[model samples]
Target: MSSNDLEICKRFAAERAVLDREFKGNVVVGIGSGSTVVYVTKCIAETITRMNKEAEKDGRKPDLNVTCIPSSFQAKELILRNNLNLGSLESFPLVDWTIDGADEIDSQNNIIKGGGGCHTQEKILASCSKELYIVGDYTKYSPKLGTNWKKGIPIEVIPVSYVAVKRKIECRLGGEVLLRMAVMKAGPVITDNSNFIVDWRFPEGIDNWKDIETTLKMIPGVVEVGLFIKMAIKIYIGNEKDVKIYDFSPSNE
Candidate 1:
């Protein structure tokens, strides 16, 4: 598919998250990285403005305001461009909600993210939030986590440990691990935290993600794995037609 179509789908998913009407009171929101979340930041800023105007008319003193904590440099820029108040996890460690874009997600609610190399902080922010919601296009919505997301699981690792991690993944876990290369610059793509990312592509799609998640996390020098097991409370998927919301309750999973 064309990049434009994917952008449209991403924006649709972002709109769905912003229009949820869940930010009723004072809220601290964790903003995740990716082209998709660019629209999410805009929607939140516009919504906050509208809410404040409504509060003024209702004589409620225009109390609606949000402090947004960004997961990466790109996400921080989005928040700034929208003129939203920026916050740091240092101050507001616990947030009301988090919105992130995933590379792929499955029916069982497992997610793989970090295609843009922000999974480390994204996972951190999600862990700090009361609710973590994933936003993505229909193409990323898979019946199983690894089928449609050809890029594989993005695993961030310490630079020195890349070789070891790559070997361990291939030998122990049964997947081909390749260091993610930079498109514009030469050499491997470096993350905001100065970590390297390796995409682990299994021969077949994953069946037991929870076990794999644990196994990957056990590897030394592995900062974080893109496999977001049971982290997403809800997922919003967008297509040319409309947006669909899938609830991921423990009982249902």
Candidate 2:
């Protein structure tokens, strides 16, 4: 986020994907959580404004009544900052699309998310949407799930039951679960919903992601797990040289 060139390139990938892709009948969009989404929301606002101006010139009303539903508080801030029409999932339950970021992804399109501790909401948005697009730099995609990113899975839990959830994960899921501590604030990091986070990392890393995610979610206090299986319909991978987009059908663009 500082003056890093890589971060800037990622911004291009995020913005370019939304700018280039056609959202023909998409009126309601689910905005996701991450640095990349910051650019995506801005582009949406810009495009909407441009469309409105063009419509006015043609003596017709602006028709792209795009409404953005944010996944988290940070995402909500981005939506408001861009001067876009803000909406909620309750109103727009079935979204046209959802764009999000991933910490790590594999050949099967499985992903490890929630480095931002917003995976709970991120997953919900993706699950609720008709299509989910994963956006990031080329570095995010890996041959194996844990080989590139081994930072562990992020799990949001109820604060009062964090201790029990941590123990359950370590005992049943075979990983070391640590209560996520706040780097900028005192004590544990609290989510927008006022829940606690527990990041679990297996010393050897994960292979059966779906099973692991299911096990973690079975715990009484666990709210959500960071492992995402077969949720993304497409991925936009960007490099300094060029950007590549991959779909679940093994096609590229």
Candidate 3:
């Protein structure tokens, strides 16, 4: 297959594997944002259909009871378009598991998310879920966070304080900070939560991501940083050949 086609197949493979393993009956699921996550929602919808059909064949009520909680506006639309039952964090409060896509996944399982400007809500759902799983293609896996994903760490900040927040991140954190501009709009890209996004291109080969995550969150007007430190239980990285699963360990934490 062509490279693009192969990458898409890899994403499908990883997403299908995640759904087969984690998507069981009567569970609340968190659907995250990004291109790869598109496959996840599709897989879930297919699974639900197959499961309900099986129930009908067995003369049982087709109640899969899988409620999907979206992490962004895009994710919400994906769930609704797929004809899945939609839910809210306020209503569910606790999610059984969450599957998301990552911009980059390091060897330690540290993730760089928010490339879609939905990291704030994504992180909220991840934190609420009992388990957080990531799925991505081979291009997203790396030995370090900045090795592959060159778009920099996405930070959601208040629109009014974006200038000040950008300055602080550049000055204190030592990175080339840039306000993410909108492609179709006139000004900066607005997040689903109506916040602005700042991309912090930090120096490569940094060893202290935990400290950096803490420092970035402490900044005023910062809604959420894309740096996910030790929050993932596992990552399913799909390549042209097969899917590789990385389990989180205490040493990596």
Best by lDDT: 1
Worst lDDT window (10 residues) for model 2? Answer: 244-253
The better candidate by lDDT, 2 or 3, is 3
Better of 1 and 2 by TM-score: 1
Q: Give each model's whole-structure lDDT.
A: 0.89, 0.83, 0.86
TM-score of each predicted structure versus truth: 0.94, 0.91, 0.93
Full-model lDDT, candidate 3? 0.86
Name the better of 1 and 2 by lDDT. 1
lDDT of 1 by residue, 1-253 (tens): 7889888888899999889847666799999988789889989988888888888888888766689999999989998999999999999989999998988888878888989999999999999999898898888888887677788899999999999999999999786999999999999999999989999988684588889889998999899999888888889998887899998856766
True-structure RMSD for candidate 1: 1.6
- Candidate 2 shows a clash count of 0
Residue pairs whose backbone atoms clash in candidate 1: none
Q: Write the per-residue lDDT of candidate 3 for residues 1-253, one digit (tens) a residue.
A: 5789756755765565556565456889999888888888888888889888999999999877899999999999999999999999999989998888889989877899988889999999999999888888888889888887899999999889998998898889787989999999799999888889999999766888999999999999998999988888888878776778887845655
Shift in Å, residue 100, candidate 1: 0.7
Give the clashing pairs for model 2.
Answer: none
